[model samples]
Target: MTYEDIRVEHRGGVSTIVLSRPPVNAVTPRLLMEVLSALDDLEERGETRCVVLAGSGTKAFCAGADLKADNTLAAGDSFRDLGRAVVDRLEAFPKPVISAMRGWCVGGGFAIGLACDVRLASTTTRIRTGDAYLGVIPSWGMSLTRLTHFVGRNRALDLLILGEDLDAEAALQMGLVTRVIPEEDYDAELARIAERVAGGAPITFKAIKETIRAQYMYTPAAAQALETHWSDIGGASADMREGIAAFREKRQPVFRGC
Candidate 1:
């Protein structure tokens, strides 16, 4: 499918969605709709094992939504609900989603990265929760505990409430970003990460995501029990047998996500 605001490129097991609107890549209704559609499409493609979310150009991942957009503001009360819904879907998507961020990751952009399972940034990356400056709260419910779980409560508050523009080093230290690569190596490093993730056992990755989600959905006791359930799923798969065989043969295992 074609998308005006973004472009999808599938290479082997990895499908990458790049926000294509340049000069800031500000989010708009079109971008939101297309992104959700892309996610839905990739979710149904069993051959796709992982997704890479990014933005075009070196200036920004997305500078947030276009404030003047008809659907964006109403006495600080509204913006169509589609954006939030898409973000929520991204958060709970069964497959792993990785965000490769550079330049400005502000407001909604920051939230988008938070939704991803893994975040990697270039040294030039500057992230801010730009909503506080607009006198509006994060529409995706900033209090959803994602940021807190990534960073501590106080640090999350510093970004959400204080609206500090965090540089790559600080973000990494806070655990908001998984890695910060040098600008010159960003492209190559991102590809390597994607290759590694896409080559992993699909069923194992799915189980890992579920176990993490279960951590938030269940009590500590319940989550512990849930761990066994996910493990059993992995243990029962054909891929598990293949993994053992490959290990004994000293060869790479080809997982079918079964």
Candidate 2:
């Protein structure tokens, strides 16, 4: 897909979407719209088993919403509605999505990473929950719900209200990021992580993603039902046949994502 402010590179079964705006990759309406558009394309294609989201520059993953952009703050809730919608999409995406972070992942940028299934960051990465020190709370779901899921209510409260900036190691410890790698090894490490997800049985991965998401969104009974539903769907896939056959034959399975 083509976009002015974003770059998408698809290889093997993994698609990497880079936030392509300048020095800080600051959030803009156009940038968010392009991200949604790219997501639509990837979902429809179904060939993408895993998605890795990262920013283009060495400076920041995303600097936050562009207050300096024309009519950004003037649009108000309409603009925030778009941000919420894109984040909802990310939260429910069927395939695994990983956030690869470096530099400043602040404000809404931090929320974007929070929505991903996995987050891996360079050692220099700094993430803030609400940036409350600036009197800015996350308009996205992170403050109300997502942050608590990652770090529990007390820790989430501390970060959201106190506006603490979490470094890479702290983020990893808090479960905000799955791994923290040195800047030198970040690229190679993230590639391996994406490849690991892409190499899994596609049906199994989808089922697992859905089950976890359902657990978050539904009651215990409802979540169990959802899990059972996905399990059934995955159990009947052609990939399952290949997996079983490969087990019997003592070889690695090659999944076609069927």
Candidate 3:
């Protein structure tokens, strides 16, 4: 599909979604919509088992939302609706989603990274939750919840209140990211991780993802319901059959997202 603000590429079972608005890669409503659309397409295709969300340049994964370009701000419901839609799409994505951070991931940019299941960053990457500095607070639902869950209440509060950027290593130490590798090895490392995830049992991975997300965001009853649903799907899936067959044959499994 044609995209104005992002690029989507699929290689094997790994799909990389790259934010393309150069330099800072600040998101606008249009860009956010495009990203949501791309993710929707990927889910519908059912072939992509892992996704890496990154930016086009070495300078930024994404700087933040472009307040100047966000025309929906004064449009009330549209603005909130768009933000919620993007967050919801990311949260519900069936596969493992990774955010590859290179430079500045700030404000709304940080929100996107937080929405992903895993975040991997270059050692020089910086993260900022800059909402307070802009005279607003973060309104993205699950992103803030996930951030607080990962970094704990104190660090999350410090990030939001102070609006200071945390370097990649510090972010990893604070539990904001899964790994921080040197910039020179960032791309290779991310590709390696993505491929590893893609090669895993697709149905089992989806089940695990659902369970973790439920625990992260839902009440016990709700989490249980989600767990049951995902368990049923995973138990009956063709991917499960493939996994078993491959195991018995001592070969790699070929999953068709079934």
Q: Which candidate gets the maximum lDDT versus the true structure? A: 2
By lDDT, highest first, what's the ranking? 2, 1, 3
- Comparing 2 with 3 on TM-score, the higher-scoring candidate is 2
Off by over 4 Å in 3: 70-77, 142-144
Over 4 Å off, model 1: 74-80
Please, what are the lDDT tens digits per residue for candidate 2 over residues 42-154? 88776788998999977899878888988677768877887898788888887789998899998888889878888888998998765666766568777777778767999
What does the lDDT read for residue 179 in candidate 3? 89
TM-scores for the candidates: 0.93, 0.95, 0.91
lDDT of 3 by residue, 164-237 (tens): 88988788888888989998888788889999998887677777777777776777788788788988888899
Query: lDDT of each model, Cα atoms only?
Result: 0.83, 0.84, 0.82
Q: List the RMSD of every prediction in angstroms.
A: 1.9, 1.5, 2.1
State, as a TM-score between 0 and 1, how close model 1 is to the true structure.
0.93
Q: Sorted by TM-score, highest first, which candidate order results?
A: 2, 1, 3
Winner on lDDT between 1 and 2 is 2
